[model samples]
Target: MLARMTGALRFSPAEIAGFAILAAVVFLVLPLALDTFRLNLAGKYLTYAFVAVGLVLCWGAGGILSLGQGVFFGLGGYCMAMFLKLEASTPAATRIQSTPGIPDFMDWNQLTALPWWWEPFHSLAFSLVAVVAVPVALAWIIGLAMFRRRVGGVYFAIITQSLAAILTILVIGQQGFTGGVNGITDLRTLLGWDIRTDAAKEILYFVNGALLFACLLLARFILKSKLGRVLVAMRDQEDRVRFSGYDVAQFKMFIFCAGAAFAGVGGAMFTLQVGFMSPTLVGIVPSIEMVIFCAVGGRLSILGAVYGTLLVNWAKTTFSESFPELWLLGLGALFIGVVMAFPNGLAGLYADHVEPRIRALLAWLGVRGAMPAPVAGGAAREMAPARSVAGGRQSGRSLQARGGASPEPGP
Candidate 1:
């Protein structure tokens, strides 16, 4: 049982190395290298990495492509935003407004009082729960409705994309409640502690990094389990898995909800790090872009998703600053190029080309366990030339025994 448990929890050496390197970069290197401002930007980018990691599990491993991850992200962000917004809108602070206790946007729109639904968010604990639960609940509903009916592939993708568009429109239309296109801005505090300070931002960045690592470990655990194998089987052969007595729809629903939960956590972190949550993030374009981040990082690679999110967002910031009008086009072209030239994304390239060379170098340097065990038939192939030489020597001995002239061995 101990052996089985150990096996179940075992991660590959490469994966272990990846986790360590990622931790070092996020926790140690970036904090030391970047200023608070740049670090905060990185924290924002890491928020999106949550969604990308979910996509790696949902789309990469399970073959369930969702383009409405932004919806979950928005829900989580809004949940946290509501809490912060409420905390900021103290009766004393908003005494000049039409509604003394309501949010400023509600006051601007001539709102009379805080809505009933917003009451629960007043509690930090409840708000945090909602941040995860709301998105997961939505995912559960969607998965039950669609997966039960066997809806998937391009159709599912389109449905998710449509949901993103619809949610964006709804948020904009409900301006009085949802803050419209301006989003929930000017967030001030968490538990009465001002969050806008540079020191606060730095703390939040580290917190975000820690949360991200937790998510990474959770994802790693899921992928390493039997459930992960089942997910892969379902991805490649759904009917086979279903026929083998597994409830395919339940598995799909579970993974879909898990992805939504991850997105929700990311969204909440985004709000804390960026000081706002907006309808712009809950739209079709951002949703698709999130998918692109996953794809570019190698949808199958959890760590790669983080790297991809950082790289793409970095490029986006750089390009948008220099060529505001052409950045979108450049992004499209980058995605196209990646899809065409590197279908498996950066992770695939590393695995096929880079990792092998690194392993070879390590092995040459006499590092133990640097090289993987040889594959079946590999040993036989390697020994073929030696076997041929041995056969030649045996033939020479036989000829000498038969009284024939022995062949001279040449150097």
Candidate 2:
């Protein structure tokens, strides 16, 4: 803890304050700088960051490439959307509305009154709880069933994809309760504020930026913890960690649930900004997009996920809507280029290009000396240990026991 804190203390006052100033400008002042349309798109990109952060944990650290983050995102959005819709209908105001207390679709499906299941969501309090609780519960149950059986890799990915597909189907099929394929729409308010107002939208965007920052900090804390090392260990060698007496299933389950919760938060924020939610939001395609976001960002790095989501989503919104024809080809080619060139993700490119320059600059300052050569070599040996092709996960266990080494040199 001291080492980490001390390292943080070394940041130049200028660098630290500049970072704060920049963030304040982007998050606080930028909404005022941009129009509602631009702010809305920026908010969407930030929500993707939330999902990408979760992906970084599951795919990069835990070796679980989940394609069902969209399901969680949709769930959260729908949960909150339901409440907002109900609120707009006015149980939240002077008097409650008539029976059914839901959108018209619920009335059309032969429903007479609000279902007991939806009763809690009428209150904003329950909706907020449901946003986090529901996704985490689903993830916990699914992870328990799959991980304990040692199901993983492509199998796990497929299961998650199926989860997204199935959820979309269910939501669409339930025309009354779920608002059918349209899911939910025409939402005009959130927390008693009219989302239609520019001021409300601006506040929502800032809240989202704050949430993204908080999630990033949370990821940093987790990565610096012993559990994080164990997570990385499990990523490299599941069976070895299991045999070593750790409850591997529990660890995996925890991360899976945490990632799901993050998705939920993102989804909720997304619904508030967009004023809509549909089966399409939670479908297989969107889930895959979430995965692609993290992969394109830099699967192994938290900040990479943020940058990748913003840059790619910005391009998607800017180009796809404008060109209509060549945009998809450009997007497809971008995908191919990223995969073919930077397998580790955009952050990998950043590490490759920028990290070295930063390191060189530090060296030139002579305030921070060069990393000791032997120690530098030992750290690389530590992060990726050698094992014969036949060794399997056993190599990671041996590697962990062998050394306490620093990180590999940037790039």
Q: What is the lDDT of residue 224 in candidate 1?
A: 67
Instruction: Evaluate all candidate structures by whole-model CA lDDT and list the values in order.
Output: 0.86, 0.76
| Candidate achieving the largest lDDT | 1
| Tens digit of per-residue lDDT, candidate 1, span 95-197 | 9997798999999887898889999989999999999999999999999999999999999999999999999999999999989999999999999788999
What TM-score goes with each of the models? 0.89, 0.83
Give lDDT: candidate 2, residue 330.
81
Q: Candidate 1 — what's its lDDT?
A: 0.86
Enumerate clash totals for all models, in the order shown. Answer: 0, 0
Spell out the clash pairs found in candidate 2.
none
Q: Poorest 10 consecutive residues of model 2 by lDDT?
A: 373-382
Query: How does residue 288 of candidate 1 score in lDDT?
Result: 92
CA displacement after TM-score superposition, residue 362 of candidate 2 (Å): 4.2
